[model samples]
Target: MTKCIRCQVDVADNHLNCPLCGIKLRESIKDTHVSYPEYPQIAKRKKLLVKVWTFVTISIIVFSLAINALTWKVKPIGWSPILSIAVFYIWFLGQDLYQKFNINLVAKTLWNNYLILTVFFLIVDNVTGYGKWSLNFVIPFLGIATGFIMTLWSVKNKSMWRDDIGYILLILGVNVLPFILFLLKAVDVLWPSIASLLYGVMTVVGIFIFSGRRLLYELQKRFHF
Candidate 1:
């Protein structure tokens, strides 16, 4: 004799399903026998990564400010990489703001700021006789803005892990975009062209990687799957 755990009905020895309830008895047996692994260390590692990123961002801002102050009297305004420092500060500030406020509007504001600054710098660089500053300023700013936007979107929707991964990839892609452009222009490298092409590929990939599950769920619900 055996028991149906679901309905507490008596079952025969050779039976797989509960006769009265029609629940699978074998599944209950398998569930009780199987073990799941604990993942506390994995959780700890993720927390550490967040802390390290936070510290690194702060250090970069402080280091950039220190270098700027030390070189203020010696370096030309156009040559001083203040735009680079500004991009870093803005990127981290956007992350902090998202974490604190979980606001889509802030993300949109940052994106707009990035575009405006890029255009403003380009005009200044072209009109006032500064070379390459516009390109230097725009690329990283766009990358950081993209990463921040994805991150904020993820945060607002409670997809923190996927959001963090997307943010990391977006940052990497943004940093690499300028180098790819340079290589294509200066050396005529096909690899840089490929790399630049990959920006679009990776953005789509990141979207799918992070949002695929949610999208699938929504689709299933919408279509009655």
Candidate 2:
């Protein structure tokens, strides 16, 4: 039997990867193999599609920017950035949907959404005559919502708490970002930043108080500190 380090489960000798989280086992046998057929060509086609799509999107962005620059005096609406953001979002969302079919990458999807929406709104805010709504309210609330969703996800997968500490730490950092932004005077609202910071602090404190020594061990193993 081969043991999966992430899920802490024993895998059969015939399986090279863990059934749960798909991590490779250290003691995986080279000669032992499954009866499933491989599809290398499908993966290659996917990669080719991604490359082609990226090139096409970048070309579109360049063309739009060139046109916008030529008509700067007549139409200075800053529409190119919004168009570029939309194109990038479609590409990223497509990639996420493709990967999510194979792996449980919901946390990564949430992080991607957070980044895309934050940037999208910031661009929109700037384009709309510096409304300041994105930094003042939207981003901090978005971070809080993301952290909440991630927390619920960890709870739903209670069996994988040890494996989940990394995500928790990452979300905690996300929660703390609003405070940093406030300190830098980037975010005008103090209440939202304080709320996000307090939420993150409470989550970390709850984990430490409840987990005790196991949390320490997991932290040490994950961070190598």
Q: Which stretches of candidate 2 lie over 4 Å from their true place?
A: 1-52, 99-104, 159-162
> What clash pairs does model 1 have?
none
- Model 1 clash number: 0
TM-score of each: 0.33, 0.71
Write candidate 1's Cα lDDT for 86-193 as tens digits.
655566566555444554344444455555566656656764685765565455546555655655565677654432443344455555666666666632334443
Task: Give lDDT for model 2.
Answer: 0.81
Scored by TM-score, the top model is 2
Per-residue CA lDDT of model 2 for 1-225, tens digit only, reads 988889988888888788899887654455667798776898888878878888998899899889988999998789999888988898889876763353346666777788998999899899889877888888888988987887788768773354456766787888888889889988788998898899899988987888868888887887799
Error of 2 at 61 (Å): 2.0
Of candidate 2, the 10-residue stretch with the lowest lDDT total is 98-107
